[model samples]
Target: MPARRKDPAIPAGLKIMAPEPAVRLAKEAEIGGLGLDWSEQPEMLDDVGLAEWERLAGVFAHDATRFREGERAAITAYCSWWSAFATAAADVRDRGPVVEGRSDMDRGRLVKNPATVAMREASQQLRYWARELGLTTDARVRIGLADQGDDKNDDDNPFA
Candidate 1:
């Protein structure tokens, strides 16, 4: 089990109004609202991404059936990294695929920022944890997730 958040932003009415699963996450993650809304408002976590983000968050937040210890910390790290992802993505989104910045060695010279690299790295972190926690759609399917069982063949999937 993980320690409670030091400063939980507990939301109003979620305890009574949210759906059963979301209510569980709110309590387990000790988050405000249904643990469904984003703090940074990243486009990556909006639209279809919102549903995916919420689902992934539920796995990290729920308490009754944790895969192992330190889950809450992992959840917090995941969200923090996602915020980083969003911020970096925002730069890329606004400036197009490439942007110009001054080189570290020489401020006078122009250099390409290529925010996509940072965006990709942040996205990779999110994806890595999702796979680690079995939160991805493909991961869920491979582990017989609909029936809700651990991936018994995890050892057999040599590539994994």
Candidate 2:
């Protein structure tokens, strides 16, 4: 059997439990940023992508430094996937999951709508990009961006 792929190493800045030695090593190994501006939207993006980009930018505004130029491509991909998913989802909603087949043999029969496939593919891609960009709640927690809920005092509460 093939070996499982290892998880990507978390950046020192995003690691909540790194030892001092590991943190120092990670800092030394970190590459310098290209200093690209995050505010500028890529011209290739359509209106839907642009809106998603803006929404994500606003979401990360408080910790903008965490996303350097190295992450721009990931952010762009996430936005693009979001746009695709949204469009596909809308199409599926309007057309329903099944539609008349356009192929020769299946012409008169009902088949799964193309939009349903698109939506599934887009959602999968979106999930991948979301994890890469730390956009999901679980991703945020994994990267030490979200509160881990460890601060609650279980000893003091009867619910514990």
Q: Which stretch of 10 consecutive residues in model 2 shows the poorest summed lDDT?
A: 27-36
CA lDDT, every prediction? Answer: 0.60, 0.78
lDDT of 1 at 69: 33
114 Cα displacement, candidate 1 (Å)? 4.0
Model 1 lDDT per residue over 1-160, tens place: 9986644577644554566875666576654332333233334344445554565546545434444333544554565667678778888778777455556775665555567888888889989776666667787677666534654667777787
Model 1 regions lying over 4 Å from their true place: 1-69, 104-111, 147-160
Q: What's the TM for model 1?
A: 0.46
Q: How well does each candidate superpose onto the true structure, as a TM-score?
A: 0.46, 0.70
Estimate the TM-score for candidate 2: 0.70
